[model samples]
Target: MFISAKNIFKNYGSTQALSDISFEVNKNELFGFIGPDGAGKTTLFRILTTLLLADKGSATINGWDVVNDFKTIRNNVGYMPGRFSLYQDLSVEENLTFFATIFGTTIEENYDLIRDIYVQIEPFKKRLAGKLSGGMKQKLALSCALIHAPELLVLDEPTTGVDAVSRKEFWEMLRNLRDKGITIIVSTPYMDEASLCDRVALMQNGKIMQIDTPQHIVGEFPRKLYAVRSSNMYSLKDDLLHFPEQHSVHLFGQYLHFTAREREADILGLRHYLEGKNHQNIIIEAIEPGIEDCFIELMTENSASNEN
Candidate 1:
């Protein structure tokens, strides 16, 4: 394992941040840690990057213990935090130089490692870090982090708050980086990004719900799903939920996604029931599951199982 975390735990003044969080990343794998805000993603990233120590359990990067070998781990991994932490007063070139110096290296020593990304923003090398656009800033931040040519890159929500175009470009850059054989472990709140990774660990609260390739996760949804839409969507949702054959129902895009209690759910009966309630323009069709659908199903099933 290029990265290994075993039963890690951390707490704030009163609230628990991470609880027995454990996972591993293989060499050169594009592994993603996915969850919503306050899902303990930052806390776990901090622990793995050796900026904070866990209260219990252990973690290692490339066989170097995070706590005992902090210096080595620091030297071997590139980290882009959730927040933009580069020096605002410094120009792009200066920031890159500073990070390289801290790692006892120079840009000339590892120029090839970052050359592809750095060249895109080299024209803005003289611009102050704070003055760059969101996409430019992300590219510069990644350039600085990679100037040291580390084997692993740990990014904590690097795309949050950026525009959609920037987010798309950022993921494209990540795909190129992964092609260069650098192990990457990134955390993101965007469920759509899950499919971009070789594997993902779905997280909620502070625990991991499932770990698998995106296809595998979506392939495991047990029940038949349908995408339902009607002219009176508001009333249609209410009527569908009240039906006795429903396993689950939730809004998805302009349609409602639902699982039927029986595989043989009567669509005609459902449409008639809504029509009797004055709902119109009913459309219900079986739809293939996506990552978001699988994630919701997993969390719902886990919660129900725990209650039982």
Candidate 2:
């Protein structure tokens, strides 16, 4: 195993940050922690990277305990935190060189590992980190993280504030890195990125709701769902929520995804009900569930259980 976390728990005063969290990652695998903000992704990443202690449970990286063998783990793992923590006054090239130097290495020693990502920002080598664009800064940060050529890489929301194009490019770089035999553990609030990972752990409210391949997780959605759209999406959603049969109602992009109280839904009856409500150009059809859909269902279930 490249990474192992068992029954981890963390709290901050009155707030519970993580609850009995447990998971593992195989060598060279791209594992993702998929969740919205405050789902304990950053907290877990911190504990796994030996930057913080968990109040309960244990974890190991590359056979070294995260707490007792923090030095070894630090040497073996590369971490890029949620916030951009590089020296903003330094240039891109300067930042990379500085990070490499700290690890007792030179950029020339591991240029191949980060060449692809670094080249994208190389033209801005002279630009101060603070003056670079968000995407450029991210690229430089990733390059710094890889200069040490560690066995494992841990990134926390590396794409949070970047552009769409940069985010896509970043994932491609991660894939290329994984192909070179470096295991990766990344956390993202973007549900779409879940598919890019070999496996993902969906988290909510400090607990893991599900952990499996993206396909398997989405395949496990327990109810028939439909994408419904009308001339007035807002009113249509409110009306559906008010309907006695609706089990779940969530807005998905320009449409509303809804499920019924019964396992099997009455499409004709639903259409008729909408027509009676003066909804125009109504479109309601069964569609495949997505990661976001599954997360929402899981969150609803978690809340219901807590309430009960």
Candidate 3:
């Protein structure tokens, strides 16, 4: 395993931040931690990167124990935090140079490793880090993180606030790096991005709900799903929830993604109910499940288990 976490636990005073977390990442794999805010993604990343200690359990990166070998881990891992943490007063070139120097290396030494990302911002090399646009800042941060050519790359929500195009480009850069055999562990709130990873660990409320390939996760969705919409979409959700055979109901983009309690649900009965409720232009059709659908189902199951 390139990375392994076992029974990890973390707490901020009385609030549990991570609970019994455990997962693994293989070498050259692009593993993603998928979850929303306050899901303990940052806390777990901090622990794995040796910035913080877990209240319980253990983790290792590239065979180095995160705690006892903290210094070595720090040297062999490139960590880009969730928030931009580069020097605001320093120019892009200066920031990259500083990081390389701290690692007893030079930008020229690992130029090939980061050239693809750095070239995007090379034109703005003299611009102060803070003045760069969000997308540019992201690229600069990634370049600095790669300046040392570390074996493991840890990114925490690298695309949270960037434009759509930049996000796409950033993932492309990551794939290129992975193709060169760098193991990457990234966290993101965007479910759509989960599909881009080799495998993903779906996290929520300080726990991992499931870990599997995006396709497998969606394929394992227990209930048949349907995309439902009506002239009054808002009211349709409430009505669907009130229906006798609802397994789950979540609003996804422009439609309400619904699953019935039984696989062979009565579509006609559902349509009749909606019609009786005076809903017009009702559209209900079976649709393939996506990452978001799997995530929602896992989150719902996790929540219900905790409540019980």
lDDT for each residue of candidate 3 in 120-198, tens digit (9 for 90 to 100):
8999999999999999999999998998999999999999999999999999999999999999999999999999999
TM-score of decoy 2: 0.98
Q: Which consecutive 10 residues in model 2 have the weakest lDDT in total?
A: 261-270
Instruction: Please give the distance, in angstroms, between residue 4's alpha carbon in candidate 1 and its true position after superposition.
Output: 1.4
lDDT of 1 by residue, 1-308 (tens): 98889999899978888988889889989999989888899999999898998999899999999999999988889999988999999999999999999989999999988888888889989999999998889888998889888899999998988899988888988888899989999999999999999999999878889899999998888978899998988877888899888888989989999888886568888878878888777788999888889888888988999899
Across 182-253, the per-residue lDDT of candidate 2 in tens digits comes to 999999999999999999999987999899999999999999999999999879988999877899999988
Q: How close is every model to the real structure, measured as TM-score?
A: 0.96, 0.98, 0.98
Q: At residue 292, give the lDDT of candidate 1.
A: 86
Candidate 2: which stretches are off by over 4 Å? none
Give the root-mean-square deviation of each candidate in angstroms.
1.4, 0.9, 1.0
The residue-level lDDT of candidate 1 at 193 comes to: 94
Instruction: Tell me the spans in candidate 3 whose CA falls farther than 4 Å from its real position.
Output: none
The true-versus-predicted C-alpha distance at residue 264 of model 2, in Å, is 3.2
Worst 10 residues of 3 by lDDT: 297-306
Q: Which rank order by lDDT, best down to worst?
A: 3, 2, 1
User: What is the lDDT of every predicted structure here?
Assistant: 0.90, 0.94, 0.94
